[model samples]
Target: MRPRADAVLSEWFGPSDGRLLAVPMSLRGKVVGVLLALEGGPGLNVAMVQQLTYTVGLMLETLASRPNVPTPALTPPEVISGEPEVAVEAPPAVPEEAPRAVEEVSVAAVEAPPAVGDGSETVQLKMPIAPAPPAAVGRAPEDERKHEEARRFARLLVSEIRLYNEQAVQTGKLTRNIYSHLKEDIDRSREMYEQRVSAEVRADSNYFHDEMVRILADGDADALGV
Candidate 1:
């Protein structure tokens, strides 16, 4: 069949077989949408078309203007059935048993034993004892790290003091006046090392002092005196 132009879509997808028409669906004065019609035969009259458009537009406007209402917490679905609902009896609830009372024995009762009737035969009783908890072996991870850091700092500081004042250290060691010979270096290194290491480490431990004794005095702790 030869193509013919339809009034509604004449520009695009034009020359359609079926006659198309578009009428505005208006609410009050503003147009909401178009009510389209594709007619193959005699189309709807003006009155019917007007009624249909007005109904659709009114519904759209009402929905748009209406305030939102909160949905029910439990909105059960509508169950459609032709047959009537049959009454079903629920199962009886099971009765629960009452809890038993726990008996508490006093310290005196536990310590004191029941006297034997004859005292002729001796009976040995075994007591159930709970296993002891595991002992804590070593320092925690953080404490160990802190300790390691302190030791490193002490070692470095002591090494530096001995490094720069090698002559003084040697002379002091021989003369037994090590403290006097390397007093300045020793004091400065001690101060800096103590400052770097925390007071917690210093409270019980003398990592820096130990390092000075070990390194500066060549394992002769008394040589460095201070």
Candidate 2:
């Protein structure tokens, strides 16, 4: 019946422009939570609410699965302007006759120079090998996993949009007036994609737009008209 909260609330608690709706959010086959929406003005239609909750679940689950990225340390305002007040502890006083332990270098541990067995004998020093690039070696697998998850999530979101609006998508492609036909839907979907996809993934490539053009527009990007 009347699920919007404002209408029911206004009758007893005075006039209110607010609206409320809640839809179940499911990830895979499990219902994890509910999408609680509150608006001071107009509310989305039932179809939009359902579609939104579905995508919200997918996005939350995917994001939760990604490894946490460390945030950069920020300098405080006092540090920038001037040195902030800091307390320094004085080191404990040592005995006047405290003997400092000095480590003796073992000469035997060092390799001896090559003996001059032959007149043509020459010595070659081994240069220290440079360390491998940390980013390339250490982060390669993590980066690959991140990109894979990003691409998969993008594909899922675009596929759902295409699946739900199949008839409209087809008609829009034929008429080449997709913007007019589904401007609101496409705009909202793109907004969701932008919001859900991390900056790292976006910097690499916009897979959402790629899939949207490929699936919804039949590989003809111009068909979507943006």
Candidate 3:
């Protein structure tokens, strides 16, 4: 019988003084690769170990999905006997020659720009400009306001639903009536937000399409594409 893989890895790294961690690279219950990390300093915590293991597992899964370099498999002696063999030959040698001399040029002897307007007119020189760094995408005031509004709306809806549900329960209705009503209202609010966001996205997409068409009609395709 074959020994367990985890037991094998445990034995391999157990004797070493340095800290060792191994994460199995698996996808859909199939092992694809393995990630090994060794630390010489202080030991790692449980949370850090778990996080590193999960990250390495994800990386391995991603790598396994991509194209990789192909390697040839080894053949047995009986299979190799049927293949043809080629002899290796070394290339002929060549003699070395002396290097040629090169002439040096001086910057002071180079021609300068001609004088403008008999040295009376002054011309301004432009300096080289560097590119600006990209702006960060962060939560804006409008987004915060929207989030607050959404939360307020959700709380109000929850309270109203709960009140109606309590009244129904007091009148001798179902026992879990309050929970059911609250769940329904919460689900409804989530669905409503999803629909609103989808509609806004579609509107923005349509506006972009119209703007592109107008720009193309005005013969400014280069700026539009850029």
Candidate 4:
């Protein structure tokens, strides 16, 4: 069976050490995809594959039967075919010639500002600068460190949640229904992380959530490196 190129499982297993177990996830005799796991020992055999397949099948059947279940947007595999070979003759090469020399133009110096009453030029050099707020200016290093820790954890949380969602989709767990099971845990963790950071930064709890949403939109979960 061919897996989509953009699939996380495909990309992940594209490079491996050769010891792997792939169990086909099927429902109603229709093969959806495969659930890949690293081979552990003798326990990783046909029986294990069959059991996993049955479990995945049950999940798919139950979720598919649910009303208003959301469909996952997994990458679908495309068909690959061969193209006819066309032999083309090479074009004759042209002779190389010496390149022409380029002329350099000199730039004029910026003129001085108009002279003031004292006969001195009043050069008002405008710079792009903004004043730091009192809260930010007086923030302790420990507070900054805490805030950074919070941001990093927030990114990690988003990355892990996305990874979980993708895995659920692969195992036939539709998000609209299955995700509600994980929502409370994710929200509690998020609140705790936010509270810890807010204590240090002296800010409202909603600020961290806002920051996480911004990070999520920008796909800045690189901190997790997953």
Q: Estimate each model's TM-score.
A: 0.39, 0.38, 0.21, 0.29
User: Per-residue alpha-carbon lDDT of model 1 for 1-226, expressed as tens digits?
Assistant: 1124334355554675554344554333344445555545575343344334433433343334334554434434455655686545545544454333322111110111232232212112111121222342586877766675665566556656655666788888888678898778878888887778788878856777777776667677778755
- Candidate 1 positional error at 219, Å: 0.8
lDDT of 1: 0.53
lDDT of 2: 0.53
Candidate 4 lDDT over 141-189, as tens digits, reads 8766555455445544544443434344223232223334445545776
Question: Which residue runs of candidate 3 sit more than 4 Å off their true CA positions?
Answer: 1-15, 59-226
Count of clashes in candidate 4: 0
Candidate 2 lands at a TM-score of: 0.38
lDDT of each: 0.53, 0.53, 0.35, 0.40
- The candidate that achieves the highest lDDT relative to the unseen native structure: 2
Q: Per-residue CA lDDT of candidate 3, range 1-226, in tens?
A: 0112236544755544444443443444444444455554576343343334333443333333344444444433332243475444444333344333221111111111332232121112111111222242585766544443443333333333333443432232234232243455545744654454444344323322232222111223332222
Q: Could you tell which candidate, 2 or 3, scores higher by TM-score?
A: 2
Ranking by lDDT: 2, 1, 4, 3
Residue pairs with backbone overlap in model 2? none
